[model samples]
Each structure stands twice: as structure tokens, then as C-alpha cells.
Target: MTELDLQEYSHSLLLEVQADAEAEGTTTPEAFTRRVLEDLEQAGVVANTFTAYHKTHGHEVHGYGVSDSGDTLDLFITDFHLNPLDSKLGKADTETRFRRLLTFVRRCGEGFGQEVGESFDAYDMCAAVGKSLTEVNRIRLFLLSNRVGTWTDVSANELDGIPVTHEVWDLARLHRHATSGVLGEPIVVSFDPPLPCVSAPSNEPDHSVVLAVIPGRVLAELYAEYDTRLLELNVRSFLQVRGGVNKGIRQTALEHPGKFLAYNNGITATASQVEFLKDADGQPTHISRVHGIQVVNGGQTTASLHYVMFRDRKDLSQVSVQMKLTEVSPDQLTEIVPKISRYSNTQNRVTLVDFSSNHEYHVRFQQITRSLWAPAKDGSGKETHWFYERARGQYTDGLANARTPAQQRRFRDLNPTSQKFSKSDLAKYVHSWHQLPYWVSRGAQKNFNEFMARIDEAQPRVDVLYCQRVIAMAILFKAVDRIAASHGAGSHKSMVTTYTVARLTLATEKRVDLDRIWREQAVSTTLEDAIDDLCPRVMHVVTHPRDGAHVGEWAKKAACWDAVSRVRWAVPPTLEAELLDHPLDEVVAADDEASSAARGEVTLVSPEEWYAIERWAKETRNLEPWQRQLAYSVGRKLELGQGVPDTQVAQALHVRNEAHRLGFRLAS
Candidate 1:
């Protein structure tokens, strides 16, 4: 037969063989294809046997290419039928269920704290999300030492700059990060990394090297939710003793590579392939735990995440204040901020974030610096600084070192506006917020910088909505501040009238702080400028603890949150795009300029006399401004008699108004 005829005839025979196979308990495409290949091999039909297999597209992973030889398939040998015996060689089963994941992560974090003999911080919590303490803390930046089994080049001997402690701890960080994510990315670690140890002994110590062992991908999802940085750094430091290098291993490292490999086939081999033995088999192994787990644009996107280190409280004094606010209904915050909830750990050292009702414009207190508002000379917190704030605007806890607002503004103003900034500018801005690398405060800063870099350089250039969001957020904050301040400060008496009036009076529109984002890119301006335009809302500021023990005011109350705390809740791509432009108002038919302008309303009402007004209105079935004022006076007198603060009296009325709106009939 002619070669062409023979090829066609062969194809037909192969198809017949595949179609006639007897049923097995289970048969996968790979297994069936393998059977066909085996028969063909036995018949001695040479050339490229894979050619036929590639033609039939039936596999989880494979690539198609038009080669010089014509259409060809690049099949993943890894995608072949998994031989249970080969794949299971050294792998261990793990807890992959959600419940088990929750438990395991809790233990991983709590146990890490006990080991470190200190309370956990945001750094530790971040480590739980798949970062090593060191990497998350920016103790050392990730230098891609190896890719797969190959080493890549990093110019100028950057490795020389890293300290041994950072290198070792970094490995632990990477290990934790790997264990926390469901990453197809290789779970890798560095070991006994060659660097100058932070502290080394003159003679060889019992443990000089550091080992970083990562878990397989099975537990990655769970680990991804944690910040493994502190845990990783601490683990590395713990492992380092006075010997050779400290070599440590995680329980997860023992799992076989096959679990991570896509296909079960061809995973088994002689020990040489895997170098299967643990520490006893070779040199100290270490890898950055959180090195690969990136935080994107201040937690805006997941594709790229960078480091946001913390601010050290030791470098400067701390301060705070609380403003009682007029109680407003959750609906008034619709499209505005909804319900705000908070939670604190038992020690109150770490506070998880607060979620808003609509889940927009949420807030969280990562760390609370001391009361910087106190008397500079008195040292006691008796002096009330009485700082006014637009909470919703670009609010910062307290920069690494907050000098005068003017000084910071000048420093920011001097920055050149001409850098071709995508986010590198933001990174530098964030990085500048740091004073030292080792300090805990620097970790969050590093994280913020890293997150920005990640988004700016994401695979597809992470969306720009992250930039616009801060502006709208800033304006609302300022407006809220104003409205609340003019109204009531948590006084029950003014609760109903002032708060309800404020809601009805104002309009909440999304507006961008253009100067803060595009040209000036100033932190203070981002906050002060936007907030200055809005009415100040009443926010309670708390000062020194009655016993120097209280960490935050709303701690113990924050509980019962299920899903993970989101850094940037995912907003639809289109909505985020819209965020770039400043929010404008509807233009009038006769005046286009008016469309760009925002309309303001006033809400300067009292809540205390609301009850008296209600009583008067109920009896006369009519309402008047005079009657309302008298009612407020009556309520205020009653509240004063009870020793309740004026603010409390106002808050009561506000709460009553909200309740009444919700179908609650308050007693006249």
C-alpha cells in the first residue's frame, strides 16, 4: 500500500481500537490514550508517535504549535495518567476542607505567638495569609535565586546586601506563604542562604544554617488568608542556633511534589530525581516564607501584592481623641457608609478591620500609637488637644513620624510631579513613610509599597480604580465629619433631630481628590483638602486608658464575623474605572457649569428636645419651630438632672429617630 494510504488505514485502525475497548471501573482519557500508544509502540511504527496523540486534544493541559514539521502538540508528560503508586511514593494526605483549614490556620498563628513569647501583630496576621514574617516585614526583599531547578541572575551581587537572619527567616516566610495559598506556583524555599548572619558566633555553633520548608499546594487556600511574615521570621530566628546553619522543616515539606504536579504520571523516580531525603540528606535549606505572596495596590488586587510594613510607636509620641456623634440611621449611610462593626483580640493588641453595612468605605485600626494629642510637657493626658478630623477622608492612623502638618505638606509638595508614575511613585511615597527597616512599623509600610508595586506591575497592569477610590472616600469622610460635629456627639438627646435632619439635608456623591492623586500626590492634601470641603462629623476620640491598659475603645464588641477581612473588597472592573474621574453633579438645563458643582445642605438641629416636640405635636397634632425648641429644652433639662452628658442626650434622640424609622414607636 502507498505510504499515504497506509497512514489513513493506520489512523482508522487506531480509532477502531479506541472505540472497542472494554469498560473498566474507571477510564481516563490519558489512560486510554496511553493504551493506544503502547499498542502502537509494540507494533514498531516509528517516527513521532506523539504526533497522533497530540492530534487528539483530550487532556487537562497541553499546548498546540505549528512547527516546521506542521501542526504539532506539546503535551505535558505531567498530565499523563497518574500512577497511584508512583504519585503516592512520599506524599501525605492533608486537611483540605474549609473547617479544617480554619482550625489549622488558627493553630498556626496562636502557636506562633506562644513560641515568640509575645502578642501577635498585623505582621503575624499577614504571615497567616501566606507570608513569612521577614518577607512581609521587608527584612529582606525577594531575590529570585532560582526558577524551577535553574538559577537566575540578579546583578550587582544583591545577595551580598542581605543579612543571614533575613535570608534564613525569609525562607520560613516563603514556606508559610506557600502553605497558605492554593498556588500552582512552585512551593519553594531557600536554605542556609549565604549571607552575613545578624548575629553569629566566633566558632561554629550547633545551628548556623536556616531551613525553610514549604507545604504542598493542598493547604494553600487556607494559608493565603494569613500573613506569614512574622511567623516565618520568628521561625527562622528560632531555628538558628550556634552550630552550622540552622536547618528547620515544616510538617508540610514531607509531602511529595506529585501533589503539586498537574498529572499523576511520571512522578515516581529514583531518590536522585527528588533528592527525597529531608535535612539528614543535605545542607541547611531556607526560603522566604512570604516572599512570593504579593499584596497588590494597598490590597486592591490579588494578581500582585507587595509588602506593607508597620509603623514603630517607639520613635514618636502618640495621641488620640473621641467625639460623640449624632446617631444616624444605617440607611442614611446608604451609598455612604453603612453599619460599622469592629472586633478585638483578647489582649486588645491587634484589632481586625471593621466592615461597613454596604461594605463600602470600611475601616480598621491596625495599630494605635500613644496619645500624641496629650500635653507635650505635662506627660499626662489631662490636656485635650481637640483635633478636628474628617474621618472618611484620607485618614491615617499616624504616619511613622508625624511632624507638623505643614512640614509634611511641604515635604510632599516639593516632590517632583513629572515622574512617569503608574505606582512606582506611590511606592516611593509609601516607602518614605518608614524610618527603619527592623522596626515593626516598617512592615506595614513595606506592605503598602509592595501592594502598590504589585498592582502597577500586575500581569495586565492591575486596574487603576484603586487610585480614584481614595478620593471619593476622602470627600465623604470630610462631609461626614462636618455634619456630625455641627449636630451631636453621641448625646442621646440630640440623636433623633440632628441626625435625621443631617441625613435629609445632605447628598452623598462620589468625588475624586484630583490633586492628591494626579499632580501633587500629597498625603496631607489628599486628606485635608478633600475633608476641608465637607462638614465635619462627630467621631468619639478616646485618650489614655483609665489604667494605661486599654488598647482601643471598640475592641471586645467586634465579634461574629465569618469570611476573611478584605483589604480591598473587589469592586466590579467598570465601576473601578469610573472611579478615576471626579464625581460631578447633574447639570441644570440652563447652566452646564452647575452640573459640575455639588449642592450643600445644612443639618444644625438638636436632638434632646425632640421628645418634647413629639409630645407637643402629639397633643396639638401640629408642628412649629418654637414648639420643637421648647421640647428640646425640656429634654435637655431632664438629661442634665440625670447627670447625662449633653452629647448623650442628643444621641438618645438620634437613636430613637432611627428606631422610629425602622417602625419603632418611641414613647412620647
Candidate 2:
């Protein structure tokens, strides 16, 4: 293998180091900045980042990236006090910090050629300024501070004819965003008193629609305040499809601001829930807060208002747009929100399937998961079930919340917490399996949209068995990922692993005989062991490109996938045998027999304990599949051995303590 100097650590690894350092009461600048970048990546703020840490010219700029449309995305970051809680920055101090960010934005506007050399790699901001690195469309100035200052003047405007917007990820916002996935934080929007609005309740208990007239300026302000975090996936994708602001909106706002509301269809939005403030008479006067606000329709209108009012500097005092806000429960959010978005935006040429969860593929997968039962294991006495959560929060609040304790137990017996995977996760796996690893690395929402776009184009209908096989493929992908991680290929940790695994599958597809492995429509131990054996070699090729070049950021880009697809490598004799030989063949009869024996053995400890562990794993702990399997295996051993052997007792106690740490309740 060729040696490439991986001297500069990735942002993910740097964050890991930062966490370890903080635990020991020490911190480094490299670690802190990288941690901030990692936080931004996790929150879906930015996809891929390249550090341009030029000693002289990297002051106003930290790094750069390419937008989905191939525009240069300049990143200006300021690392404020590592501990915001300990910072005593006053109002003036905070304003000064924000002003510095504005100055940096101005610097980017000055021109990239001026700050650094004409050659792209001279500044290391981009590879080819003359070729692919065209113009800078967005300048994201991230103020990594512990304090949230009252800075509202950072409005959406233009710099040297290019539209500019900024977002401040302060400590409070960062902490809230970091925990939001686990705690389900509400999107709070506090409005003035006497906020005139009308609420219409639906037959569904937790769903409703609220109608209100909001000034175009107000909407622009919110868009400016929240940035992309405000828009849902459907709306966000629509806005991208429409490009920048539509000329029609600007003309209406500029010429007839008073009649703009009458001529326009306004906007349709959705929220998880809405909170209201009441007057002395107990009538709802103002909408106090809204959870998960997303524009379902009139994305063009919403974007136009923001552009016309903010960028065009047009008056919008009389340009009030009607907003129809549909409030759905969290459990129903994923299923209903996209439907609302698609149904409302009929004026656009957007594909309905891309905005639908009821597509034939998803429906077919749901049927397959619900009908087929996994055999019982670890003496549970009941067959296990797999619940394919097509919608967000379906596994927890949607299905599990309505079931009785015993019913939930049976569900857990069939589908352990580890076997649980979401629709978005499935999309990544399916795409990776097809050798589209770059798309898989684009995060869940983007990847889901990408997958659906392909589905809408190809209309490749799948059967129940095919759906089951896809799930089996996902499990095998995860097992291989663990093996790679164990081998210290820490760079494969991100969604990028989807591409690596895809490359591996594509390279080895001819030899592996995937059709034979899929005959049973489940992940068998023989298949798992085969994947485990191949992962190290797969990861090695992925980490070290055969051309004696470091496959660094290239792996995250589409070019890497294209390059890997054209390369060929040698496979070991044993791996070749495992791939080529069928399980029923005499040469592989021993493995087939072992698999048959495993089918009858109990894999779970106790049904009651398994249920509790599964619940804890999904809701409280959010443990990985391997972690859940370990806990289940330990629990089973404890039950079978009655905590007799000292080693067994120690292992059992260790897992029991971990369960307690994850907030799992103990038996009385």
C-alpha cells in the first residue's frame, strides 16, 4: 500500500479529540474550530468543508465548499470562548463580534483573487479557480460563541450585486440543535400581542390549520433570522428548483405593493404544534410559538418576498401575504407534511412522487415488513416483528405508544432495537448498493430526495421479498462499517461510508453472488461473516486509492465514485469461495447446517426485559444496532446462567449499569 501523509485530521476526528480534551480540562484551537465545523455538519447547515488555513490570508476566511449548484461557498468562522457559560461578554462586546463577521463578509466580497493568489490551490480554498471554482454565491459567517446577543440587524441583503445572508450559531442555538433530535425541541416563534389569526380544527385530534395575514417584511425577517433551518425538505427542494427569486414577485412588490396580496396566492405552511397567548377574556390573541414551521406551498412567493423586500429594498408594508399553517402531531409529521406540500404546489412542475411517502416502493416495503415475521430467538417463545417506519417518529410515538405492554413486547421480540432502520436510512443503503455512494453521503434528507427523484424517473417497482432483501443489505452494510471502524479507518464514520460500501459492493458484485445471498430475504450469519471478511480490504481500497494518492475529500465528491467504478483489484481465494459457492452446495453444506441450527436457538434473554431494553434503546439511549445486540446477548446470558459465573456476572452487571445509565427502569 502507498503511504499518504494524513497529517491533518478530519473535522470529525478533531471533534473526538476535543471531547476527550475537554473531559480532562484542556482544549486546543484546532480541536475547538474543528468541533464547530462538526456541529455545523451534524445540524445539516453544511455538507462538506475544506480547510483553507493559509497562514497570512486565512484570517477572514476559515474554509470553503461548493453549493449544490456548484457555486463557491465561502466560510468565515470565529471561535469565541469555548465555554459560553463562562463568558462575560457584554452587549458592546457581542456587537463588536458581530461587526467583525460583517467585515469578513465584506472581505469575501472584495474578491478571492485579491485575498489570495490567482491559483486556486495557492490559497487552498478550491482546486481550480479558473475551471470549476466559478463565483462565490454565498458567504456563511459562523460566529462560534457561547453568548447569544440581541443582534437583529444582520439582514438579508446584497454585496457587490451578489445576494448575501448570515446565520449566527450561538451557544444556546447550538446546544438546542444538538439535543433537538433526542428531546424533540419546539420551534418557538414569539409574536406581538393581538396577533390576528383564525384556527380550524380537523377530525384528527392533534391536527389543525391556522390562517393569518403576515406582512411580507415580517416573513423576510424570519427567513433571514432562521436561514435554511426554517424551511422543510419539500419547500427547501422547491426553492432550489426555482433557483433565486422569481422576477414576477419583484415586479409585483416594486410596482403594486398594495395589490400584491390580491394578485398572489400567498403561502401554505405546516408546523408540528402551535402555542397561543390569550387575553383577559381567554380568547387567543397571539401565536406565541410554532414547532417545525415549513412552507408547504408558495415557496416561490415566500422566497420572492424575502428577495424583493430585503435584496431589492422594496416596500412591503402593504404587501401582506395570507399564510395557511397546518399543525400536525409529531407522529404524523413525516407522513402528512409532504402530502400537504405536494398537493398545495400544483402550479410547479415538481414530481409528486418526490414529495410522497405513499409511493409504491414505500408502500410495498411497508407491506413486506408488516407481513413477514422474523423467527424467534433466545427462548422468547414468540416470533419477532420488523416495523418499517416510513414516517418520522413512527417507531416510537406512532406505533409503540398505542400498543399495550405485552403487544410492545412481541414487537420487540421480532425486531430488536438494532434491526430498526428508517426510510431515509434505507434510501442511503439502496443508493449505495447501486454504486451511487456520493448521493448517499449527502445526508439523509438530501439522500432521500435524491433516491425519490431516481424512483420517479425509473419507476422501478419492487416486491415484498425485494424490500426484505434491501433491509438485509442494510444490516450487512452496518456490520461491514463496524469492521472498518475497528480497523481504525475513522474517516469512514460519516455518511461517506455509504459510498465506500457502495464502491466495495460494485467492485465485488460479480464474484459475491448477491442473488444467492438474497434467496432467504434475511441477513444470515454466513452472509454477515462473509461481509466481515471483505470489509477490511474494501476499507483499505477506499482509504488508499491505488494511484498512490490520498482519497481525502475526493471520496465525498461524485468524481471519487466514478474513479472507483473503473478500477479493478484482486480478491483472496477464501473470499472468492464465499462469494461464488452457494450455501446448499456440498462445499458450503457445513455453513448452511450451522445456519439451520441457529434458527431454532433462542437469541433474546427474557421477553419482558427485551421489550424494556428496546424501548430504552429507541427513545432514551438511541443505541446503535451492535450496542443493542451486545446488551441483548448479555441480558440473555444473565437469564440463562442465573448470574452464576463471576465473569458472566461481571459482564451482566456492566450491561445492567449501562442500561441504568440510559434510563432503563430496573425490576422491582
Candidate 3:
């Protein structure tokens, strides 16, 4: 927010990157580049198939990501400096880096895989990009730097008639994004000829509502340009259910374009700001531009429209669809936007699980980490916290919130950046331990979504014991990760580590004493030895894909897991002796105490506060119809000064909790 804050953030980020390199046993430059790519993937700035490859001659490329449809390719090049905080990437250097990345793309399009031997790490990526060139309509070249950059404008060029755009994610830009509450870069849509719209009457000042009929052609074009960035808030991916709504929408768009408005549910969108064109009476009549526009609902409809217009080459000139656009202030974007998305899609059976970050499970898990302290390790008497970053920038925010140098130092000592883990990291650890190695091998974001879905189904209680088990899982994962790095697993290290853990779990029958691990804060040496023994065997199975398939892609398949599972590497006798006699219980009797304490805390909220929460939920539409009725009943009972039963109180508390999670705030 200020110059001093920026400086502190920059220094902290560089230190974190260096710490990652040390933990992963890689050079700082490689780690810095990989970290940047990982962040970009998590932020939805790039697709998930990003692989790191650093090879330079007359051209260079650090990493590459290919879209699922094969229509978009992203290439990255890094420019690292020793003194990143003080260094700056000038315009000329930026242009040169972009050119190098473009040259690599050009070569890949021209079948450079032949020159790059099949044995090389990058050969598969090169060959794939070369083969997919015909389908690739756009290529984005990124220059990743830890230094500040003087270049601001993104230059667009073409290679072999395919549009190639250049972007630079320098230190300052990366810092701004990290601190900002929004996801990825904002999509600012400017209409060449403003569309006429009618503003809905609204009593709220934080947001305004508008109703309009948008041209189907315009929607398709916008999708083509922005793609999934337009649907960032929409958790649902475009599912092609046969003969379902998607197919019907496509058919209607092609056969009855003029009737789309009458048949479809249209789209619900949000914007942080909007420009209006008013008539002589000063009444808003048209929308000229919108900032931070995101489609929260009707993703299927939007994607179907894109498919019909672009893939099918259908005329959408006669197609018009209704749209409800909510212009929310920047301050309310994080809080209100998710509620808008969740409520708008409730008719489709979307639950709070779809918004996993805000789910009660994660919220409780975050609270546990904050309150629980880990045992002191390495003979130090000081205990530290393993910080679980439930949301992005929280760990940094913790540091930035400290008012003085002494407070900052104390914060760092307690919650070291090295001890920090994200939701994706937790997903990878838990999924690996559960013997879903293939899913873990998939990139972080995808694996995290799958893990959340499983969590929804299982509905495990988030108590002290559960939190300890999660930490034990984290400890086990990091131990295996370090062992894998030591064994020269190289690019296949992640697959090797996950498979090793999964195989061990299967062999030992999930009998590891996670409670022991949590108390001791370290894995037993015998167990580490067993992991060491399994690493090379797992590596062999993962790296040697059947039919010479790409190892990375193959690692994501069930067959790979099956092959690794079939390996005859047994847990060593010593480690087997250390395994627990029985599997850990799904629930502990002690957790009931914790649950009762939680409920007691909930009941501590005064009746007046509950009434206020009900009113807020009503005004904000934060609760479901059923939940709203319950809230009203609770309010009525409180108003009548009648004692409410514990069951009714708990239900009311649940409603209030859900509303709070969705950003409902009672008047102070």
C-alpha cells in the first residue's frame, strides 16, 4: 500500500523463493521461475500443464503450458538477477527476452523436435506443440523476472499468422497481484458501440443492478478473447452432458437464434465498476465499458455459444440473450461476489463445497492451525506454528499487519514462511497418503478441486485430532519430498514422491501412527529408509511409461498408479514393526468435547445479534429459502423472549455461520 510496505513485501518474497529452492534442492533461479509458474497456474493466468524446461541457444524457453483444447499455448522465459530487489528489467531486455521465447515457439511450430532428441526432457513438449500448431490460434509469450520492469505496454505480434502476445510479470506486478484480493488480472471490457441497457432500481449503495440483452455474437467474441478469465468466479466447468442443457442450448443457438432469450436462463455477471451512457434526462441508458467483469453463472451457456460460433461457424447475428449485471464496489468484490455466484447457481445443485476456500471445513482448519502449536524440533525450546494459508496472501498479510520491526520478527519466528502451506499443498499431501497418487500427480489446482469434492462426500469433522493428522500427513509428505530430491528424481520427482507414499500406505495397510508423528514432529528413521528404498522403484515405474507415452501425462492415468502399485517393493521389516497395529479411528471421542465447546461459543452470541444476523441475511439474500425460514423463526422466538431449544439454537447458529462465511455482516 505504501513504498515501505512494497519494499518489505519484495524482500519477503525473495526470501521465500530462496527458501523454496533450499527445500527443493534446486538453484535459486530455477526455483524462482518455477514458483512464478506455479503462482500463475493457481491464479488461473495459465493452464495446468506447465512443465519447466530451460534450454537456450539462439532461442530460449523456461516453461510451457498448453490449453486443453489445443487452441492456446503459453511459453515462458525467465530473467533472474542476483540483486532482485534493486535490479530492473529495461525495455530492450524485455523485448529481447520476448523475442527469444517467440523464436522457441516458431521452432516448435516448424517441428524442432527432430533436432531435440527424443531422450531430451523437452522433446515431448516440442513435438506436441509442433503437432498442435494447426489447432493453436494463439500463443502467449511471458517474460518472468524477479526484477522491476520499466516496460508496461504489452506488444502483440504474429508468428506464421497465429497471434502471439507478449507480457511481463516483473517483481512489482507480481507483488501487486499477490496483495490484491482479486483473482488474476481484471477483465476490462470496452464496447466499441455501447449497448443499450436499463438500470434496475436498487436501494443498496454498495452495488447497482442492470438488465440488458447482449448480442450472442458479442458474447462469443468476448469469450474468444478472454476465455476462462471471464468465468473466474464460476466454479463449474463446462460439462458436455449428452442431450442435456448444453446440447439444447447449442441446437437452439444454431436453429433458433432469436428464441434463445425465451428458452435460456441467460447469464449472471458482476463488475467492480461500469461506465454508463445517459440520455438528455440523465437517465442511464447504455453500458459503455465494464471493469473486472466476471461471469458468475451460465458458464455452460457461454461456452456453448463459443463452440457454436467459432467451431461450428454459425451466424449469431439474430441471437440475443438476457443478462443481469451487478456493479459491485471494489471493497465488496471479495465478499459479495462469491455469494452472488453461489446463490445464482443454487438451482443447479451447487453447494458451498463448490466454493471450497470459504467452506466451513477450511475455515475451521484455518482456525485450528492458528490455535494449535507444533512441538519444538531440533532441540529448541521454542514451539512454532505450521501456518495453513487458507487463502492467498494471508501469510504475507500476517507479516504486513505487524506494526513494528519487533512485531514482524516475532511473527516470522512463530510462522516461518518455510512452514507455510497452501490449500493445494494440503490436497497433495492428503491425496497422496490416501493412495491417490495419480490424482496427486495432476497439477495442484486440479488435484485440489478433486480433493475438495471428496471432502464434501466424506464430511469429516474438523477437530483437534483431524488437524493433527493433517499435519502428520504434511510431515510425511515433506520427508518423502526431501528423499526424492536426494535420489536425483529430477523432473519426475513429484510423481516419484507421491507414488512412494501411496505404495507404502497400501503395503502397510494405512497403519502408520500419525498421532506419533504429530507428537514427535518427525518421521521415524526406519520409515524414511523404507521411503528411500521405494523411491527408485517408483521412479522407474513412473518414468518408463507404457508405449513410450509422455511420462507427465501418463502419471495422471490410473494405469500408471496400477503399475506402481504392482511393484513388489515391500516395507522394510523395521518400518513394518513401527506401523500401528490398527488403522486410525475416523473419529475420536475427545473431538466431541471440542464440538461441544464450539457450539457453546456459538450460543454465546446474544439474541439481539442473532436477530440482526437474520435481518442482514434477509437483505443480502445470503441464506437459502429454508435457512431463511429458520432464521426468521429464530428471530421470532428471540423477539417474543421465549427460550429456544438447543436443537433450534444450533440450527440457527448453522445458518448464521453460513451467512457469515458468505460475507453477511451484522451492524456493529
What would the per-residue lDDT of candidate 1 be over residues 1-668, giving only the tens digit for each residue? 24333233233223322332221111234333333332222111110122111111121111111111111111112122122112321111111111222232233334532342212222222222222222222121111110111112212111123221111111122222223221112223232222211221234321121222222221222123232221111111111111111111111112322232221111000000111122564432322222222111111111011110021111101111111111122233222111111111111111111111111111111011012121222243232221111121111112213356565444223221111121111222222221111111112222232332222222111123332322222223333333443433211111111222222112222233333433222223333332323212211111111232221211111110000011113333433443435442211011223211211000122343356455645554333333344455545655555333322333333333322322223344
1 or 3: which has the higher lDDT?
Answer: 3
Off by more than 4 A, model 3: 240-243, 346-355, 585-668
Better of 1 and 2 by lDDT: 2
Candidate 3 worst ten-residue window by lDDT: 346-355
- What's every prediction's RMSD, in angstroms? 30.9, 19.0, 11.1
TM-score of 1: 0.18
Report the C-alpha lDDT of model 2 over 281-391, residue by residue, as the tens digit: 775556767767766677667766766665566778888888888888877766777677767775443443323556766887777787767555446565655567654
Q: Between the candidate structures 2 and 3, which one is better when assessed by TM-score?
A: 3
The local distance difference test score of each candidate is: 0.23, 0.53, 0.78
Question: How many steric clashes does model 1 contain?
Answer: 143
Candidate 1: residue 568 lDDT (0-100): 18
Clashes of 2: 9
Highest lDDT among the candidates is held by which one? 3
Instruction: Assess the local accuracy of residue 286 in candidate 2 as a C-alpha lDDT between 0 and 100.
Output: 63
- TM-score: which candidate is best? 3
